[model samples]
Target: MTSAKRVAIMVTCMVDQVMPEVGVAAVRLLRRAGYTVEFPAEQTCCGQPFFNSGFRAQAADLAKRSLDIFEPYDAVVLPGGSCAAMIRKEYPHLLERWPGGVARAEALAARTYELSEFLVHVAGWQPAPAAGAPRVTYHDSCHMNRLLGLGAESRALLSAAGCAIVEMHESDRCCGFGGVFSIRIPEVSNAMTQEKVRRADATGAEVLVSADPGCLMQMRGFAHQTGMRLAHLAVLLEELTR
Candidate 1:
């Protein structure tokens, strides 16, 4: 248990409103790994929605606010991979145009980390043994993998949890749950999500895991809309060592 000096939890907007349990599971995961954890009550949406929507000023303001909220910690542990990716990836670009705020946003990015990244890279935590775990497949979120470069850490952790890692076809494809992208481009988003759901189903995996809540929400919706069933990675991880 190489605990982080201080770890802050950043619960993204959708999770705050729809699925807070995912946030709780993240806290449990961190605390169990011996990280001193704190959740800033002032935290809100990571401004990604606005940023992605091309609202630069509003997104920069929200980014500034997030920097203020999280800058003091040794590491910012973002439960939602999309939010973590936004603070790290998009902020730099936002700062590129808004030079006045680059330092703060860049500093925030310097310390920010997705949950599994912090767990494995910073905190040095691993999943508890799960020798009899069910067949599980992972969906690598675009932001977490491509943007944050988390590599294969989450997949390894899931394997440690005693689950069979069934690699789905085009496992890296976007699930079309691009937050506002889904609403803005409903047909495209819906179609993409449907394809992802179909692929995951094709693997015959009992669960599909991803670090992004937006992806999870879209996948869950597609499951409900299309009558497909798959458990989230968080749901599976939370079920362990209780």
Candidate 2:
């Protein structure tokens, strides 16, 4: 019955281009939950970058195209919270001036869910226990946590999957991966990242997990210097469950 629900995977540009493995893990997890996962080849950016850059016209155009690509699916799932939030939270606002745009964006928003949210809430998924539990800390990505209101879902799922949760200092603080914000203000961003890496390292966690690919990449930049292992939540979950 779950397979009857066709979900389109919106592989965010970062995951598609830099971290395809996270997308692979997402597919694996969705398949294990009995859903028919799909990739809409015509899909492109959700327009967050443009929107964040104050290019409303360009962002709205991309959002409209995204609506067309994902509108036919039963649900749209993406690994990054930032992009998911862009669609679920910002799409309607961005499309407000277009004809029937509000309605279309709202409809798409209603069916879109972040992967952890979809898995935990819609699919009623629970991971099988791993043979050896790893001590881990969770990073609450800004958009995913504040915009999408998803704080405990990842922790809850990880706990159920048999990970020993280590409390990272200020786990909810921003990791400075505000898409282009990092590029715009590298000094400030690097400082914040160093602080975040310090906190993650202080936890002495065997691995640090984040649901957002952006967050994973940002933290991974300092992992070598910090001696902290980093993993996307999908990858961590897939491994634990397998």
Candidate 3:
């Protein structure tokens, strides 16, 4: 077991390449919660895309690489829920065939947590109410909700931040950004995202918040049609706290 005060940040590929500000916001939030944050510069994709694409061998290699890089930290937290779920839910199965792999993967999985999960559960930290908190609606990304079972934790944090919670219909429905799934079938993905935006717009919320970067990216493509703004939960929280 590692020291509870030291934590590692797993900056997912989407955040690293597309929305780096999300990683910065995540770091700020972790520091605010009184943890020593470390970013392993060597960290890269968690092999989720490979695993999802049936490239198990390549995925296993990256999983082993990730484990070697992050295993030393007391806890691993990620801004993107899908990547967290990849480590927590898929690593063990992906590494099962290798000698001592399952045990190592399980150990890492036990320490890995989604950002909102780490903040609300491990840190037991709550934000001071925001000044003139904005009205917001939340989107439950697939891996975060179904695999991690973490829909309420984020909403609880948002509520604590004094944001008025507006429930969008089918909040847990997939935003159609299944990583490669969107790229493979963009028409279906676009349709799904449009429906998601329509629901959020219907709520009349000022911002549409999601803890998963993949979902945010997918919905953002349709931002022109919606009146509300799009925000990653980490960025929204960091802004609210400041």
Candidate 4:
């Protein structure tokens, strides 16, 4: 078991390469919750892309590498729910063929959590309500909602932060950024994203918040059509807490 006061941050590929501010915000939030956060520099993709694309061997290789990198932490937290889901739900299956791999994967999965989950469930954090908090709508990324059953944690956190929650129609609908799925079916993906943005726009929310970077990026591509601002939940919470 790792130290209760120490946790590892797996800032996943999208956050590292695209929206690093989310990772930075995540670190701030954890520290604010009184944990000494560690970033294992060797950490990389959790192999969701490979695993999704039917590259089992490559996915397995990366999973083993991730397992090695994160095994020592008392708890692992990620800003993106998709990557967290990859580790928590898929790692054991990916490593099942390797000797004792499944057991190792299970051990790691038990300690891993998505950002809001760690904060709300583990840290028991409650933010001082923001002054003049903006009205916001939340998007529930598929892996986070369906796969991990974490639909309410983020919403609860947002409420605690003093943001007025404006529920969008079908808040749990996929933003259609299924990683490679978007590239493989741009027309369908774009259509889905457009619908999602339209719903958020209809809510008249000033900001569209999501815990998943993939959904943020995908929706952001279409954000220009509407006045709604895009933000990751971590960034929003960090700003509110400060």
Candidate 5:
């Protein structure tokens, strides 16, 4: 709301290496909405990688590093719901498993926010008008919806941006790209994702919208395999302002 309100962009590992533009776009949107945005390059992975990998010790260390790097900001925001859910929901549990984990994670998670949740609920963003638009559907990220309880904020934002938000049958279904789960069981993940892709196709939507790149990657692979087109929410939002 003012110059005093500082926002830290938590550019997750995937967004940092693969889709830096999504991070850039997040900064743009927040800055336009009147917040002073800053990127703390000292920040690295959010520790979920190791936690989900069954390496709790490494995860604790990584969590400590992340907490130190991002703790100073007034509010920390991430583009992906899974990463954000890690901060808001999973980090505390992971940290508390050993010594000095709960207090540390609580301190950090208190200030964390998902971009869409922050934009719509905290910033009170008004929807942009919708013209005749392509049929679009959103695949709710498991962590975001089930873990963070982030309901409709992403969809509301898209709808406001004038995109046709179609319900892809089981919109709340998991896409099977559960971090290490996919690597551990590729066939299972593929089957789960194929079902998701087919449901999206059933909506007759030209594009599939999702908040996380992991889901996007798996689903995109299936889409490509089936010759279907899918897009992430970051890319779709980027198109809205253009």
Candidate 6:
């Protein structure tokens, strides 16, 4: 058997602490695509929470530490779009100064990719045929959609995996899990998530899928009451493909 290509999995803090199954699904998917995945023990927060909270120094420190841990790998994959965007889109700008930081940040950013993007664009993965297709709607996390412009990648992957994609009203709308934004203004945050759940529920899909854990967790808060099933794209794809 041919050896698997090596890749690093950046399990964002939310997945590590809260929804670890997403990370597990990510590994399984990558492994099936012939990748040997590793999680750096030194990996921690992507510094996005600190950066979003205006803790620039703390964010910078964490970014540098993350760069150090992921630097050696040819490819680094993130299960969540928010953290992937933090590293790929914001890292260079966040570390523009600090003596040679720009080169390091840009280099790492070039190699980083969101899971679906990597699976489709890099690995050229075509999932195993599913026994049955599921009707699902997708939530495009703010960072995933606007920043990373990855709205198509996940949808494409789901279609390729035989999921019937239902377009929800304002499918690209934010679920209001903006890291610190939710905690600082929970009233507005909860209202946004409620609306998100409402739109998703209206689709009559079996599951609501999102690429970011933050959005998944936020929507899940209202999903139980709304009678909606929520899942990360990794988990959803894994289940479908298997």
User: RMSD, each candidate, Å?
Assistant: 2.1, 1.3, 0.9, 0.9, 2.0, 2.0
The sequence of per-residue lDDT tens digits that candidate 5 reaches over residues 1-242 is 32486799998998888778778878877776668899998977988878898898888788778888987887898888988888878778877766777887897788788888888866676546557656788899899899888858888878878878789888999998998999899999989998988888888777888888778877877786554467667666766755
Question: Which lDDT tens digits does candidate 3 get at residues 1-242?
Answer: 43469899998988999999999999999999999899999998999999998999999999999999998888999998899999999999899999999999999999999999999999998999998989999999989999999979899999999999999999999997888889999899899999999999999999999999989988999999978899999999999998
Best by lDDT, which number?
A: 4
For model 4, the stretches where C-alpha displacement exceeds 4 angstroms are 1-3
Q: Using TM-score as the measure, name the better of candidate 3 and candidate 6.
A: 3
Q: Between which residue pairs do clashes occur in model 6?
A: none
* Candidates 5 and 6, the one with greater TM-score: 6
Per-residue error at 126 for model 2, in Å?
Answer: 0.3
Error of 3 at 76 (Å): 0.4
Query: Candidate order by TM-score, highest to lowest?
Result: 4, 3, 2, 6, 1, 5
Over 9-31, each residue of candidate 1 has an lDDT whose tens digit, in order, gives 89787778988988888888878
TM-score of every model versus the real structure: 0.93, 0.97, 0.98, 0.98, 0.92, 0.97
The 10-residue segment with the lowest total lDDT in model 1:
225-234
- Please report, as a residue range, the 10-residue window in candidate 5 with the lowest summed lDDT: 125-134
Q: For model 6, how does the per-residue alpha-carbon lDDT over 111-145 read when each residue is reduced to its tens digit?
A: 89999999988998988657687899999889889
Rank candidates, lDDT, best first: 4, 3, 6, 2, 5, 1
Candidate 1 colliding pairs: 130-162
Please report, in order, the local distance difference test score of every candidate based on alpha carbons.
0.80, 0.90, 0.93, 0.94, 0.81, 0.91
- What would you estimate as the lDDT of candidate 6? 0.91
lDDT of 2 at 216: 86
- The local lDDT score (0 to 100) that residue 32 gets in candidate 5 is 62
